[model samples]
Target: MKKSAAYWIWTICLAPLIFLAVVWQKLPGRVPMHYNINGEADRYGSKNELLVLIGILFAVNIGTYLLLSNIHRIDPKKKYTAENLPVMKRFAFIITFFMTALSCFIIHTTLHAGSGFNGKFVVALIGLMIAALGNYMYNIKPNYFAGFRLPWTLESEENWKYTHRLAGRIWFVGGLVLTVLAFFLSEKAGFNVLMIITAIIVVVPTVYSYRFYKQNLNK
Candidate 1:
């Protein structure tokens, strides 16, 4: 039961949910549970539903942390090396932080109906997260549970490194562009554009990985 640094990080991330729970009775009875791309709350539910959402979020983050921390125990092919430990810890921190932000945003939007949470901002935050991940993707050692897990990449360490390096550049640039676009475009238009950019970000790397593998095979 010796907790790792990631456990501490997750605890910090969960703090806001605990705070919200303490103040739950004071919140409005009918709260906005879901919002559309236009920044309007299209769905409504009891404030108590927030508790369910928070519980699910907490479970997901903790479960992911445990699975990742003990990946070696589950996957025989993927053992955690000393060199990869820091990278894995950093990845866990990133996921926890992003979840924390999202949980807080949901709570805030519920508490303050006019809080102006919109798709553009959410997309921008996603962009920022993608960029951050891209920055570290190249540092990640080959693992079954993480990184660009295309068959080609997983099969060859060379393919994994090369694909990640290329993917890192694509995601960083794509993410930056998406973040900027989120500010200038209309909410609906921004969401459409975000989808396109995301598709490109995902598809390009996968195709490249396969091609790279094929090239190596031909050699």
Candidate 2:
């Protein structure tokens, strides 16, 4: 079953490259390769630039899938279980799906050139991805590769459990807000909110984990 899942995961990771190949001939000599905060195409480059970008994304996608798939083997703690395996694979597929969609979005943007990429749409996509991950974060077991994995959290299962629970809530709510802001705010404003919220989600958990560690020491 896991091998079948791996095959599907790799197929999804390769989808963007396949898509690019099909549309390669249709792309113009110069295409919009970069967009400004306002979502206007500001940099033009050869269609080969898109090819390079797709190649890089594909490499990253495959590398991430491999790492997640084998994370249990590499972890010294080896805290994974038969149940945890499916969850990890599902998360890997979610990430693969997001990257594939992102690559397709970029290709569509390049193909349409001046149609103007929707920055808000990308923002919302990221938000959705974060929210989806957060939804699973609570169930994540202690692995060296994923989650808060702080020194303090990894040392103590209690810290890992409580910190992840808190972080999961923070991320889910923050992600939802970011998604809503993408619809209502300017691109720049939406990005600003995303940065602030991302910091909050990361910092809050780190601080909480450390505090939990200190308090336990005092006890």
Candidate 3:
């Protein structure tokens, strides 16, 4: 059978569920359901809760795919173009894959109770995700659902392009730096650095967008 985007989406989404089913019998009756900033398990729940969590993940992945696949129907201002569909599909795939990986990590950690799921690792993963997104940020067409949808960017197509291009670079570089720091710095110190980088990536684009808008308005 020819593979398609939907086929990949479903396959990626279902892999975790299948893994969970295979390992369900091996899991303890009570498992770590949540963790703290210090990479310690702070909450516990019945193993059955994993089933619930998996169900939710499946729903979110499928729901998000369906919603994005039909985003043009919901957004009144913009219709899906041939150019945007592949970008959107790729975005959806990235999100689903990330979620699947996260869920599997959670399950693995829960199974091995003492094995700490490093908070810094999650930070690093998020950093990598942001960096991956940056690669496509410039290609994202103006839409209500994604990208840096600030008032100024939404109001002006030029503002959107300029801001996204700038934001993409910032996020890509900042994310790599954050990922490196996550490995070297103490968890507390790494978390602080991550926040600072996050602020820079977000605030810089927002300020630039406003300025871009104003400059255009005055012209």
Candidate 4:
């Protein structure tokens, strides 16, 4: 069959959502689409609220893709051809798609009770590891919006350079730790661990960026 040119690609990004949609139908109890049932069972929520949540997520994905796709200037000064751009874009699309799928998987698995030990979150966790591997394999240079973005990493050329190098190492280690956590930890513990990891990832680079900025100022 003729496919969606972007087929399987961007679609992969939404696989978790599709899984949820399907699982929602298949599961014994009725799971609301928008609002999560919270800490209660056999409970339903306002449809409006549920739609809003989905809307927000939809917006986030579209916005994130747009922001990531266009942020880097294609080294305009270098001679490049249009033919190569699509393939290059596809690579990026794949990376981003995987990131989204992974994220949603993690969210879905963590939030629901019967989702088995590792449901979608484990998939997301795996996707993230693959992403890290891809980043290393492609030697894909980091940009402001891609792969371990931090203000310190983007503030200045030097900061950006040092930050990504640091970030790459951080993400690699973090991904590894999280991957193990995904397998062994209880779901609650796993989510807590993920949040802690995310916090460290966000806070560390931000603090480092400020320090780097100050040092540069002094120099």
**lDDT (CA) for every model shown?**
0.79, 0.85, 0.82, 0.53
Give a tens-digit lDDT track for model 2, residues 33-105: 8888888888888888889989999999888877776677777776565545666766787788889999999
Error of 4 at 158 (Å): 0.8
Mark the regions of model 2 whose C-alpha exceeds 4 Å error after superposition: 81-83
Model 2 TM: 0.93
Question: Best candidate per TM-score, number?
Answer: 2
Candidate 4 lDDT over 43-80, as tens digits, reads 44543444355546656666655554554454331222
Candidate 2: give the clashing pairs: none
The alpha-carbon lDDT assigned to residue 135 of candidate 3 equals 76
Error of 4 at 112 (Å): 11
Which residue pairs clash within candidate 1? none
TM-score to true structure, per model: 0.89, 0.93, 0.92, 0.57
Best by lDDT: 2
Worst 10 residues of 1 by lDDT: 74-83
Q: How far is candidate 3 from the true structure (C-alpha RMSD, Å)?
A: 1.9
With a 3 Å backbone cut-off (N, CA, C), the pairs that clash in candidate 3 are none
lDDT digits (tens) for residues 1-219 of candidate 3: 326755877888898888898899999998888877777888889988878998898899888877777776666556436667777777777777778887777777877888876777777887787778777788877788888888888777788889999988998899899888899987878889889998999899989888888888899
